[model samples]
Target: MAKQAKAKLDRKGLGSLGLEKLIDILLDEAAANKALKARLQTALAGEMGPDEMARLIDKRLDAIDQSTARINKARARDMAVEFSALARNILSELGAVDPQAGAERILRFLGLRFPISARLVADSARLWKVFDDTETAAQELIQSVDAEEQVLLVPHLERLRLRDRYGEHTGFLLGLTSVLAAPGAHAWRDALMAVLADEPMKFGALDLAQRLSLRLADIDAFLSLEKRKPENRRDTLTVAALLAEAGRFDQALEWVRERPRGMRLIPVNGSLTSVGPEYGAHERRMLEAEILERLKRREDAQELRWREFSETLNPEVLKLYLSKLDDFAEFEEMDRAFAIAAEHEDIYLALDFFISWPRLDLAARLVERHNHDWEGRYYDDLAPAAEALSAKEPRAAVLLYRALVEDILRRGIGMAYPQAGRYVGELARLMPELPDGHGLSTHAAFLAELRRNHSKKYGFWSSVPGGMQG
Candidate 1:
């Protein structure tokens, strides 16, 4: 006898159980579950009209706002579910019947964000996510409301912004830029500008004003706000990129040409090190090239692209350079690019380029040529390159695997022993396929060397299958 398949719990399956049965199940579940009961009551109120629905949702919001209890993890999760359900009712039930009322209630719900966040004993990602999602939905609802209504809601939004003590609702107001009518936008701009006027270095106000200006397509306002800050290479590049995007090529060019100042320090081995004023030189040059292209300086653009490619061995830049060449010139340029990549100072970068370019044959040859330079510390690049070369170039793969194994044992990185053990297994499998004069030791010889040098690395040998006999 064959086993029977279980019925799925989908709408179709449930419908077959009859509406009376479904109602009985809901009654049983709702009696025990307070959240479900509230949701059912909200749904029942929706049938009365948008007014009744809004009243119920407003009552819940008021109760939530008035409560000052510190919510622990479990209650936080439950509260998140409740808040999400309220937001859904506001958007679906109230929004469908009366968008204006729905939008107002959404704003009221959003106003509870700071208070709710403050009352939490510990951080609640679940509650925060609910708020983020509700904000997004509120934006959509507000956009759907009448323009005059949007103008009226600006004050409410401003109130919300003013009450945001923790900067939790960072983009809430700025995200409404598209939905705001001209009057509403002007009102919002004025309010943010007032904040900036009183506190010039206020990051939140200045950021909002600048972003709103861009949304209004007012580039001058954006730049004027930018000028308030001290100029640096990073900001200069940003202004230039924005100018280029706005099709003001000449001004963009001037911004890009501004002499970069100040040393940009970056983390290296858990310490800050100065990378000089040329920190983002590559991006600056690329942006300059783009501006030159827009200005019809094809030769200059190609020249800049080639320089970037030569210095970085970037495949994308090389492709862009090749794309601009006349027909049939791409093939010749590609060969030139490959030769440049083979001799690039960073062997790992060159390998990355070839692997990304899918020129595995050249990647294998490049690996063999720079065999001694393959560092296991750079397994990030070498491991993937080996995997790519395994089928067609097992010998090269063996070399990379050997480097990885040696580096792990040499450094005594116990955490990486299992990974090294896997590599050892691969080397053993690839040994038979290796031709003579590969300039690499046989698999047995390599294992014996590992044992001689790192005999106490039991963690590594144990992880290897067959106790390293492979």
Candidate 2:
């Protein structure tokens, strides 16, 4: 006899239960769950009409706004759940019948952001995401309304914009660019310009106006606004990228060649470190190469790409350069690229390039040649490289494993003793297959050396089976 398959409990399967049964189940569950009860009541209110549904939602919103409860971490989770449910009801129930009313309600719900955020002791990411998602939904609802209706809602949008105390909804106006009629957009832009004129240092209005201009494909306006700010290397790169995207290759080339202003300080290892003016130099060069390509200067582009590859051992750039060559020329260029990588100053980068290129033989040789430069602390890289070479280049694998084991013991990282023991086991297994003059001592000699240096580390010795007798 065959076994029977279990029935799935999806909507179709649940529909097998009669309507009365489903209603009874819902009512029983709603009795115990307050959130469910509120949702059911909202759904019931919707059956009457849109007005009644709006009134019920407004009642809940008013209650939420009137509450002065200080929400700590424990309460935040519950608040997120409750608010998310409320937002769903507003969007689904009220939104389905009357989008304009729904848009208004969503805006009101969004307006609670400032006061609600102020009452929280800790920042609740989930709670904040609820508002963020609701803002997007509100924008969609507002767009669904007719043009005249949207025009009427402009004041309401302005109110919500003013309520954005934390600048969380900076893109609110920009998001409505497609929905706003000519007059509404003009009015909003004028309003933003007025704020900018009054407060020259206010970046928020400037950012909004520039983004709006871009959305409208008004590049001239964007550049005019960009020129109002202080010139910096980062902003220059941004403007160059914008120009390149707009197919203005000549202007982009000129911007990319502009001299960098000064050294920029960035966080490194929890400390501020000053980088040279050559920051973003590689990106600038790559952009210039692309622009040159667009200008029908193929040789200049190829030359720039080759220089970048030779300096950084960047395999992508090398591949891009070689791709533009004739069919039979690729083999010779590949040989040249390999030679350049072999002599590159950064050994690790060269190794990475060879590995990515899948020329494992060259990778193994590079490892063997730069044996002394392999630092065990970089196990994140060396360990994987060793594994990749373990099959055909067991000698290189042995070298990397030995470095990892020595570093662990030397640092007295007792937490890694088990891992060290495993490496020791791997070394013991690979020893018999090693060729003569592998530059590493025999397995037994290596074990003896370990015992002499790390004899005091009993924990490590204990982790190895047979107490290192192998």
Candidate 3:
């Protein structure tokens, strides 16, 4: 028996992205003479030894080889026919022969056709990259391109003025478009790429490129004024605005610098960090709105909007907006902040603001919204949990007294946590193994009191005995 021929597909050659199509056509041609081929192979194999069978396979491969060239020519003709038809269609979607539009169309053509194994189209993009290399490279580059690729781009570039980002920065249209068309920092990266094209030159290319490529860490380092003081930063930031069009700080960072220092490096690793020129809530909303609109991601845009009913004059206006808006999964940040605002005891408001709330609940949720100080909120929440322990509710007075002992730590007093001496004795007499001890970082004096009262049972003088983390 003769074995089937085996050969790997060749990826190289003109416009071979369509190789599978050509292969299909070759197989179809072979199959058309099915009866003749079967008889011929049977006779040939009968007379031929195994070594000779290999020669027959080689001959068959040679015969198939001629078919590939023919397929390529046919495909080229088909593409040109399609391109002409597509050219007429372009008049409808694209404006005119203006340089930008022509350049844009060239890019669009390259992008649309490359993945189909269209070797010609891939080469075309490469040609454009080369043309971008020098002043007169475009025409020479066109000459080298296959006749098919030249048909469309040659006519288009006659009037384009792309002196800014051509040459070594030649791939802006492809790379920038590719990056921006992707999900996140690609847009920002594309904006920064203009400097490579000599357009308002500023920061070092490799540095900016490397930094933006660091995934979500873009938010970690705020654009420091220090970077701006040395020149290029202002122009660079401007370019960033024009390229992205979203997150227009409008010199907002200037205002931020006037204030004292500290909270600079963007919200850790979150996207919208403010090094000074941070965007206000309204501005951030508008910018995000425009981008989503352009991307045709309207549903996502709408989802980012906060509620429309918040009072404009509220002290925590941003907080109110946050509660109304719903972009982030953590919907309760503003809710928690506002809830914390609505309570108190012997503590001052200014001081409560200082207590490092990095404190959270079971789900790492902020504890403020859990209604720590408000009797109404706590009674409402704890009511069910309290009822669950109804056997203890039977001992309500004693438990209520124990609850007061717990409050010594639960209160959101700033650095000031003066644990009243009254509830300590009963708490130690009851629940001994609470998660955190009585010696919390809440305050110095209060911690001292907790240690004295519950030293034998509570161990250390703590405050937040049951808070969770987010």
Give the RMSD in angstroms, all C-alphas superposed, for model 1: 6.1
Query: For residues 1-470, could you state the per-residue lDDT of candidate 3 as single tens digits?
Result: 99996555655542454778766765676476443343345345535543343344334333432333322444555544444333322222221323233233433333333223324422343333322332232222333334343334422321132322223332332233222212324544544454445533322342344345543234323244234332323323333333353343334333222332333432223222345544344444444544554556666544444321121213343443354355884447555544544342222231123222211121112122332432422333333333333233223222433344455344533232323233333333334332345322323343456555555433223333431110
Error of 3 at 257 (Å): 9.8
Please give the distance, in angstroms, between residue 385's alpha carbon in candidate 1 and its true position after superposition.
2.2
CA lDDT of every candidate:
0.83, 0.80, 0.36
Top of the candidates by lDDT = 1
* Residue runs of model 3 more than 4 Å from their true location after superposition: 1-470
lDDT of 2 by residue, 1-470 (tens): 99997788999878989799999999999887667877898899988999999999999989988999999998888888888888888888789898888888888898898889889999999999999898788787877877566656666676777787656765565577656655555566666767786654433566666666766677788788877765441355656778999999898888787757787443233223466777778888888888899989999998999999999888888888888888899999999999998998888888888888978899989988988788777877777887788888889888888888899899999998998888888888777778887778898898888998999898899887568574
RMSD of 3: 22.2
Question: How much is 22 displaced in model 3, in angstroms?
Answer: 14
Provide the clash count, candidate 1: 0
TM-score of 1: 0.77
